[model samples]
Target: MNRENAPSTLAADYARAVDDRQFSAMETLMWPEFTQQGPGFSAESRTVFIANLAVLRSFDSTFHLLGQVAGEWQGDQYRGETYCVASHFFQRDGRSLCMDMGIRYQDVIEVRGGEARYLSRDLNVVWQDEREITAPILG
Candidate 1:
């Protein structure tokens, strides 16, 4: 793809990597110095970030729906914003519950060896909701 579309694709790929529990993919998507900041959470280095992802294993499933994504070249890096609705599913007392978080990711990326990867990402949670699931979850 073109350079202009690389950031958006990278954002979506990150969501998939997280949701699918493919932590190894992060090595290719993030720089070694990658850092992540989120609500009450912060990690330095891609290795630390990948290790921190173990928390996601506590959930039964997760789905991150990527929304608007836009970026612009800034000197030697690209700055972008990615909107996402992240849903976390789990069972509590034999009832299914879901927690949905409206997240905005402020990202910074730099291309290395003609491949773009994240240098840093800050996750902002604009809103959140939690409710019981009434419909059956289908695969």
Candidate 2:
């Protein structure tokens, strides 16, 4: 595939893997020494990254993105942006309250031995709900 097509293709596959909670597919894109950060390191480490998928899977409701690409791939690497929104509901204050959050993903992909691997991914906060929400990063 062409350089541009490569990243878009990767993005599509990744979005699906994420929405489906298929964390194993991440191994296909993540390099052993993957170092991901841009404005904020989304996950502390690869292990932490994988662990979050479990949290995601446990959520009662989640709304993750239009699955669009906001960046491009260059040379032997792919770089792009992605988005995801997830929500959870529970009984509180005699009513159901939802916790919602949005993740803006800025990523880098490196192709090795004919496979595209993740070099880095930075996820920034875009939005949050107000019902017992966690502290938001205001930087």
Candidate 3:
């Protein structure tokens, strides 16, 4: 991909990997020193990041990339932002629940040897909703 399109492409691929729960593939897209900082979370390495993803997967979730908000190339580095929507579905005590959120990712990516790797990302939650889909049973 050309320099102008690389960031968006990488972001899209990463979003797809998350949605598919393909942690292995996600590993290839990150730098060895990859880090992510979010509203109330931080991961300083790919291993920890992937492990955090595993926790999210436990809820049975789906992520959708709404769009790439903006992007720019600076030297060998690219900065971009993307909007996303996610839904987490789970059952507790036989009651179904869901948590949905609107999020934005501010990413810094670097191109090395013609491959793009995510150097860092800051995730911000724009909105959220939590609801119970089934009433709790009472004995």
Evaluated with lDDT, which candidate comes out highest? 1
Task: State the TM-score for model 1.
Answer: 0.94
Pairs of residues at least 3 apart in sequence or in different chains that clash in candidate 3 = none
Q: How much lDDT does each candidate structure score?
A: 0.91, 0.65, 0.81
Backbone clashes for every candidate come to 0, 1, 0
Q: What is the C-alpha RMSD of each candidate to the true structure, in Å?
A: 1.3, 7.3, 4.5
* lDDT tens readout by residue for model 1, 62-87: 99999998878976699989999999
Is candidate 1 or 2 superior in lDDT? 1
Clashes in model 2: which pairs? 29-118
Model 3 TM-score is 0.85
lDDT of 3 by residue, 1-139 (tens): 6777777777788878888888888788899889999877899998888888877767756656566568888989988888877777777887788888888988899999988888997889999998887644659
lDDT of 2: 0.65
Per-residue lDDT of model 2, residues 13-129, tens digit only: 666787676888877767766655534335656666766568665554344554566776577877777776745554555555667677677778887777776777776768778
- Please give the distance, in angstroms, between residue 13's alpha carbon in candidate 1 and its true position after superposition: 0.9
Model 1: ten consecutive residues of lowest lDDT:
1-10
